[model samples]
Target: MTPNALLLAHDKPAALRPDQLRQFQELGYLVLPGFLDRDLVARMRHEVDRWVDDGLRARSIDSVKDPEKFGVPPVMELELPAHGELITWSPLLEILDQLVGAPYAFHHLHSDRQAPDIPGKPWHHDYEHSTQTDRSATMIHALHYLDGLSTDTSSLVVLPGSHRERVDKTARAHLGTEPLPGEVVLEELPPGSTVVLHSALFHARRPRPGVLGKPRYFVDASYCEVGPLWPPVKPYWRYMLRRARELNLAPDRSELFTELTFAEYSRPA
Candidate 1:
């Protein structure tokens, strides 16, 4: 697909066009510029500020790194009202239903306000298959850029069609965030844009060094196509799902928070 074709306006259509679905299936990612409502985006941005300023984000990280001591986080990103709504945003789910093409379970949600000087991330994918086996089933990450991308912000660089390769998540880490052939650099987007990615697609965050611009508000959520017992990334993943269920985050979608979708939680070696 052409670079311009990669981006679709956020019309919240009843169903995605056949070509849009085909774009995601073929190129392994779809850019939905201004996918979220401005009001919702504002609310989410407020919550993100509270999440960071209140030390909740650090606590959540601590819980993950030392679950034995920290246990479940005092609050999860989904617990925030705006974030909860975002998790079950009907239009987003409808698109996921089309892309995933089957019942899927909520994998995880993360919120952050990245500093202007945040370092670039090496190329990697977040696909979670327990044994690094086949990619028969689909998994996706909805990357929500609340404040959106700009020359001042770190740009997202994705290697098109990389999900088809059955490789490790960091197979291209040696390349750092350097430009590569066939890479798509997403640098400009309006506020509230979202990029849905095939979980195995190789992507990286390319930060512009020495420019102290505004903080980037980002929230990402992932879902796994039901069938295989996928591995849970967080140690308190059960608690996370339970909270989502209790909060009725997916009242209409019963399969969204069911623990049956996961095998067991295991820390990475």
Candidate 2:
């Protein structure tokens, strides 16, 4: 899609209300059922299939492991046409801008299709902090369920208000993917649903047993509020941002691709 067309997607985003903002601040997450555009979601699924099947996804991972050897990937996820469009999809960015309450930088984007029997991922958080210090700024992960959730598919389980606890991302790892008290099991949503999460919020993926459901097309892209120099997860983050700029994903927001928004890349402990 053209840059002008991408901007139009932002024109009719559901308004973010004061109460919703308060809920996010207090609850640590918000569920926008069927928030993503249908056409965009369909295109994203195509890119996702190609990303996994064409070996680009594996190549991207290999580069991250040994940057000195692999260097920048031959192709990045955002380099994919639909993936690029999704990153700057206007409505999504508007919600992000409101939640962050300041300029933010694109952190990373991950795309994958889970098999029906894929094992449940253990409880964890994606907040990137080497020191595991206080939550001074905001970082969010937009978890997109292209096919949505159902009884047969794996479900997202999250602990409400977990972001308030200043614990390491793995504080709850020992708990595994088992259900917990006060947890919310998100099992049903429409095709283009998105669950926007505080990166610090604890969440898990629980797969259904004895039910081999359809493949789950999942893509998550994250952004960090601009304040402190945020750490970059990918060794080739510079290349990633440069590609986004080359593609003009966010033509109006220079900060989205600015190098100054990030600290030097470090191998996480």
What are the per-residue Cα lDDT tens digits for candidate 1 across 47-88?
999999999999999999999999988899999999999999
Query: lDDT tens string, model 2, 1-269?
Result: 11111112224655677877888898888887777888899999999999989999999999999888988888899999999998998888888988999999999999998888999998999888766677889999999999988877899998878988888888999988999998888888778888899999999999899996889999999999887888899998888898899999899999998899889998854
- Give the clash count for each candidate: 0, 0
Candidate 2 has which clashing residue pairs, if any? none
Which portions of model 1 miss their true places by more than 4 Å? 1-14
The TM-score leader among the candidates is: 1
Q: Compute the lDDT for candidate 1.
A: 0.91
Task: Predict model 2's lDDT versus the native.
Answer: 0.86
- The 10-residue segment of model 1 with minimum total lDDT is 1-10
**Model 2 Cα RMSD, 1 decimal:** 5.1
Best by lDDT: 1
